[model samples]
Target: MSRIAESFKNGKAFIGFVTGGDPSLEKSEEFILEMVRGGADLVEIGIPFSDPIAEGVVIQEANIRALSAGATVDKIFDLVASLRKRTEVPLVFLTYLNPVFNYGFSRFFQRCADLGVDGIIIPDLPYEEKGELAEIAAGFGVDVISLIAPTSEQRIKQIAQEATGFIYVVSSMGVTGMRSEIQTDLKAILEVVKGVSSIPTAVGFGINTPKQAGEIAKITDGVIVGSAIVKIIEKHGENAGPYIYDYVQSMKNAVKELD
Candidate 1:
């Protein structure tokens, strides 16, 4: 079974985040290992871009640092190729359209498939842009996941239709960041996506605490914690792994309540 589908069948939501090239390639790999050990059912390795418009301050800075360190598309594949040896959890690439275009969509997907990546989350490439890439992805058995905002039911359903892996449901109206509380009618949003798509749905944006993760897990197939995990890495640098472990464990413990 696909790692993502297998996790949902086990009656647990998944936790995914984007950590492309952090302080260094070595540290980035360490961070991923920590996230896995911390109860992440899937990991989104973002290939650092020159301009990450969808990201907030925390991740923007990380991208800059990674770019400065020369984290390229080739480097990211190499990192994933190496990581494939140790980790078996689903690995999804979160990237922008420009990089994919630059790398040649066919070549990019082929390399990722060769390296054992299970899925991809390209924020800028909306459902309208899913012609060639989607075909390329499907041929390799890689799911091309899509995202939706809280405001657009029409757009949400359209995005969900194209979503091969889990549909990423943005919990808020703004760009990605950590927030104190989730939107009030999150359950309704999840239901909206659920009503349209047979695939699993995972919510992200502004999800910070274990309490929030628990609450979100109650509604969707999974909760994605990005800014919170980024904050841990920002605060502790190399010691970020332990923080990731603790925080992920808290969310996992919370999910256990539902099971």
Candidate 2:
């Protein structure tokens, strides 16, 4: 079974996140390897953008550093292609709609297919605006994962119905970052997602600890931790892999509690 599906069947969903050119492409590769070994069922590699308005300070800085280091969309694809040699765990590309458009949707999805990417997550692509890209992705057998915010209810159903693979349930109303606690009623939110999506539902945003991951896993298919992992990369530099491995292992152990 694919690691993602297997995790869901085992009553636990894997945590995944977008790691842009933060430390460096080479270092990020090692970090991804560690994530898999540390029990990540999937990995979302972020293609750095110049105007990352949806990210927090930490992530924005990481993106800049990545861009400054010459991390291009093409380079990101090459890294993803190389990753295919190491594992079968699903790899999802996370980016803004602009870059996808610039690269040409049909060609991008086709290349992603060739590279064995399981999915794509375009944060700015609304369900109402995804007609062309969605059609092309479906034709290429690439899953188009969609997101739902705290305020979205009716729209959530539409996104879930049209979305492939697992749905990314944004745990907060704000942009991506670490938080003290996700103040929203995630249980109610998950129920809304469950009502529309036959696919698994994974919660993200503001999750930073195993305790939080365990709490969310009780009612959802998975948990996604981002800024927390990025911060580890920031602090440990080249040692990011070991730090991520340790954190992910802790989250994995916590999620296992639900099983």
Best by lDDT: 2
- lDDT score for candidate 1 against the true structure: 0.82
Which TM-score value belongs to model 2?
0.96
Error in Å for residue 135 of model 2? 0.4
**TM-scores, one per candidate:** 0.95, 0.96
- Give lDDT: candidate 2, residue 131: 87
lDDT of 2 by residue, 106-139 (tens): 8899998898877888888877878888889989
lDDT score of residue 79 within candidate 1: 89
RMSD, every candidate, angstroms: 1.4, 1.4
Clashing pairs in 2: none
Model 1 worst lDDT run, 10 consecutive residues: 10-19
- Residue-wise lDDT of candidate 1 within 132-165, one digit each (tens)? 8889889988888878777666676676665777
TM-score of 1: 0.95
Candidate 1 C-alpha error for residue 20, in Å:
1.4
